[model samples]
Target: MKKQYIFAVVVICLTLTAFLLTDSSDTIVKYPTGYRNWTHVKTLVLEKGHPLYEAFGGIHHIYANKIALEAYKSNKKFKDGSVIVFDLLEAVNSDNAIAEGSRKVVGVMEKDSKKFKDTGGWGFEGFNGDTKERIVKNMYGECFSCHLSQKNNDYVFSQYRK
Candidate 1:
């Protein structure tokens, strides 16, 4: 009986160790808490006729932290730790008027020159809907590929306007 109990404990430990070792990623982007209060950079609605209306068509709002906002205003390279959030929400059209609907995803671009050097010094992530569930598996392939087109703008698509 004691031998069986010891074996069970060993098995549990090994299982836990394996699980820890097999976690998705240690460098996963953290959910941006209090991002709503950040500086509002812009709002764009990608209607059905828009060029990028398939994958990202929605009521997208951009928010930038202080560091990111400074870069936007200065037109300089984004400093490390500058975080920009893209809040993607459904566009509910009622009575020929459009309203903000449920959230689709909260996309984020966090600048870290050393950490994300391969991805043009930015880390990309997407939080599924309103929850903090991470959806980005391949930051370089899934995200950076599309963003590469905006290489001149520091791999950022949206431009800051007054």
Candidate 2:
């Protein structure tokens, strides 16, 4: 009887764990629809030999929404609801000219002070290529670790361009 009771408790615990893991709550950051039409903040290209070449080696464009744009231009802390996007593409160097190739990934940063309180009121997500499929398995360790260094800049790396 004791063994059977322990088995039932284990099963209940497993079921609760599965439910929590699969909870479709607001913690999940959605793909930023209509982000292309947002304000374009800046652009950059990282080629071979650069320290960040392996992971971020490519052409990248940064975009900001209204809230983020104002904060970026004014040099103020990004408020809640601010969003920034990092659009990366392959760099094609041909005919002595550099051009944009296929898209590599689309990274997004969303701010929600109350909801995303753990990650400094920001949630990071990466979409594979042009698809909406999520690629980031570990949000804090993978993305937040780098952003954490830019704490003074409200956990953002890109600066305002003239």
Candidate 3:
């Protein structure tokens, strides 16, 4: 009887351990909803022959939620619940003028201080253009690494243009 009880306790502990591990991994960021209707921050074009042309050659539209916008405008760190979106679209030439084309990707950065403590309180994600499938499974190596260089600016690269 004692052996059986011990075995049961061991099983319970193992189950709890497994549950916690799975839950942490499942904390992968979710796509922010209704980000499209957020405030338009800026627009940029990465022209061909530019250094980042191959990776980000497109017409990029940046948006930010109210919280993020406030933080940007005030030059403060982005607060928790802040969200920013980078909408990338193809740039096509029509009548010798560049125009926006189909979307290429939708990149996002969500601020949750505790949940994303490993990445400067930011959760990064990239959604594919067509089906909105998430492409960036992790941000530590890819997104956060790049943004780390901008630590002086609160890990944000974009500035609010007056």
Candidate number achieving the greatest lDDT relative to the actual structure? 2
Model 1 Cα lDDT, one tens digit per residue, 1-162: 999999999999999999997675645676889999999999999999888788789899999999999999988889998999999999999999999999999999999887788899898999999898889989999899999998888888777888
Q: In model 2, how many backbone clashes occur?
A: 0
TM-score per model over all chains: 0.82, 0.84, 0.83
Ranking by lDDT: 2, 1, 3
lDDT of each: 0.90, 0.91, 0.88
RMSD of each: 5.1, 5.6, 3.0
Indicate which candidate wins on TM-score. 2
Candidate 3 residue-wise lDDT, 36-115, digit = tens: 89888899999989998987899998999999999989998889989889899999989989999999998889899988
Off by over 4 Å in 2: 1-25
Model 2 compared with the native: what TM-score? 0.84
Per-residue lDDT for 24 in model 1? Answer: 52
Q: After superposition, how far is residue 145 of candidate 1 from its true place, in Å?
A: 0.8
- Write model 2 residue lDDT over 1-162, tens digit each, in one string: 999999999999999999997786568778989999999989999999999899888999999999999999999999988999999999999999999999999999999987778898898899999999999888899899889999998999999888
